[model samples]
Every structure is written in C-alpha cells, then in structure tokens.
Target: MIELKREGDVFVLRMDAGENRFHPDFLAAANEALTEVERAEGPKALVTTGAGKFYSNGLDLEWLGAHQEEFVPYLESVNALYARFLELPAPTVAAVNGHAFAGGAMLALAQDFAVMRTDRGYFCLPEVDLGMSFTPGMSALIQGRLTAPVAHEAMLTGRRYAAEQAREAGIVQRTADEAGVLPAAVELAASLAGKDGGTVRAIRVGLYKHVIAALRGPALPE
Candidate 1:
C-alpha cells in the first residue's frame, strides 16, 4: 500500500512496509495517489519514501515469473509511471530510507531530487547481475539523469552505492541519517513548492523530451 499524507505544501507518499515491490496493485495505488496530488489545489510538491528496511526492492519478480505473458504490459505501465514523474508539475523528491534496487532505484532517479539514508541502505541497479538488459526507455532515463561515467559504471558493473558514494556520483543530492531522510526530502520539496506548476511542467518536458519520448515509446519484446 502507498499512503499519502499532507505536510504544509508537500505531499508525502509512504510506501508500505516490506520490499514495496511494484506489483500491479502497488502500481495502481501509487498512480491513484499521484492523480489525487495532481488534482488537488494549492502549492504542492511530492516526497516519496518507504517504511521498514527497504525503500523498495523493485519489480515483483515472483509475480512476473508466474505470469510471464504480462511482461510487456507490465513494463509499459512501469515506463508510463517513470514518464509521469519526469513531467510532474511540481518539484519531487525521493527519500530513500532504505535499500533501493533495480526499478526502485529507477523510481528514485525519476524524481527531481533524492535524499538517502547515510547510516545504511544502498542504491543499485542489478539488471546485469540478474541476466536482464535495460529496456530502451530505462536506459534513456538513467543516462539522462546521470553523468556519462557514473551511468556507465552503474549500468555495466551493477555497483551498489552507499549514500555518500551516491552523493559523490550525483545519484543523490543529499544524505541523512535514517530518521532524517524523509524530513530532509520534505524540506527540500517544501522549499520549492510555490513554483508555477505550468512553468515547471513545461520546463521539465522540454528538458527531458528525449527521455520522455523513449519512455512512452513501444515496449521491447520479452
């Protein structure tokens, strides 16, 4: 479950305890929350975080394994969500309170800023290790967000980056102790909450045009 709460002008989205993997239900819930945020009035920004030991462990692989035929549609939905975040009309932040792996890491990347827990937790893209390749959209999203060398290392080596390492590599903008992650993210979002939504959306769309195009493009075959 994804819980949506309001704190001043910022909306905090708390992912459920456990791995917070992207099962279809979880995706639907998140999208619904996003919809509500988008529709609501007043100054607004968004901060996404998770409970327990994992910010998110990524895809629901077990479900995917049993429902092989759904792969294409599932990835399409995932790409749509990423694209949506890229074009969201307000500032966004990811408060990575715990481990963020695979698609979870990608989710964080989709945000405008990331604040991660420094005492522990890791951010990694394990696609190569898992014997999977990045989809074109995923590749574009990562490449667009990170510098050439950082993106290369992360995608090719499947490195697990600790908070400080991630900040140095520009993967995350800030690091905090576990308890401070969400607050830091919320603070960042709150600071940027009053920007004109139309202007923000337009600028983001123009800046990430190629990435959004790739994400909204056709999904690769399984």
Candidate 2:
C-alpha cells in the first residue's frame, strides 16, 4: 500500500492502509518503493504523504491490540523499515496532510523534513501507553528534533497536537492550511532541487551517514 510517482525529480510516495492495518504486504510494497527510489540515482527528493485524510493513523492500533502475540515481530519489522527510511541517501520530506499517530508519526519523523497541514489531524506517539518505549534508534532523532520539554510531553502524555504546535515544538518544519501544505512542501523541494545536485547530495548523504553508522555498529553481546 505504498504508491510511488515521479513528478520530475520529485518522487511522491503515499501510504495506503490495507485492511486498516500496516499489513505485511504493505511493507513489501514499501520495500519496492525504496528500491525504485534508489534506482532513480543522482540527486532526488521525496514527498511522502498518505491517502485520504490521515498522513497515517500509525500502525493499526486496533490490529496490534487484537494480536498481542505478534507484538515483538511487528515492532522488529517496523523498526527495520524505519531504519531503512532513515538511511536513504536522498532528501525526504513528510508532507503531512492529516493525522499521524504512533508509528505513523515516527514514520514521518524518519523523513528529512516534515511539513504539515494547519487544519485537521495531528501527531502523537503513544507507545508509552502500550507499556513500551521509543525504539532506542528513534529516541536520538526525537531528541534532536524536539526540545526537551516538548519531546518529554509527547512521549509521556501520548496526546496528539496540531500542526502549528508541532512546528512550534520543532517536530514539524512548516505549517500551512490543508490546501497549502503540499504546495509548501513542494516549494521546499523546488528550492533543494534547484541547488547544485552534487552539493545537495553531499549534504544529504553526510547528514545520514552518522545515523547509518550507528545502525551498522557492533552489537552488544546478548
């Protein structure tokens, strides 16, 4: 349930929920999308949003709630998927058009930039309520993007907040009306695409190199 389209150098990726869940099949589709994105080569940019209103309702909470036995593997797969997104060598933007909850919010944060609609929907991460914690890898990114108090509240309260609030908190980069969000994201993309391709690639790759190194580092003895 991932849709990929190319509008010049801008690749538009949309997540479509299957059976109201992240279904393994959907992750397969995302894998292919990542493959094609890499194939495009050179300096490329991505604009990722979701179908319908929600940027993503996050991982199907109801589905997760119903299948408790699957929790460990589900988190394992999702964490792997998120790590892949973070390691991509290109600039990625989250054009949040609606709600982003839990995993959905984390997925958006995986992108290089997050631009959200000022209207409906919001962002939240409620794994704490589920008796777990943010994946260790995700914790650093959250701390880097959000101020101490804001990040603490989001992780602790599990409450959703609007786009403007997210921007103010530093989680979202830009905020615009529903109709303006995508355009604003495109505006940012256009600015990046207009610059020197090699310079842009260098900046993008250099920034993520540290994250990837961390991902690939030696594992602690179990």
Which candidate leads the pack in lDDT?
Answer: 1
Off by over 4 Å in 1: none
Cα lDDT over the full model 1 = 0.93
After TM-score superposition, the amount by which residue 88's alpha carbon in candidate 2 deviates from its true location, in angstroms, is: 1.2
Candidate 1, residue 216: CA error in Å? Answer: 0.9
Worst 10 residues of 2 by lDDT: 213-222
lDDT of each residue in 1-222, candidate 1, tens digit only: 899999999999999948999999999999998888888788999999999779998889998999999998898889999999988888899999999999999999999999999988999999999999877899999999999999999999999999999999999999999889999999999999999776888999999999999899877933
Please write out the lDDT profile of model 2 over residues 80-160, one tens digit for every residue: 666677766567788988888877887887777899988788898877887867655556556655779988999998978
Please report the candidate that would top TM-score against the real structure: 1
List the candidates' TM-scores in order: 0.98, 0.83
Model 2 TM-score on a 0 to 1 scale: 0.83
Instruction: Please state every model's RMSD to the true fold in angstroms.
Output: 1.1, 3.3
Clashing pairs in 2: 58-104
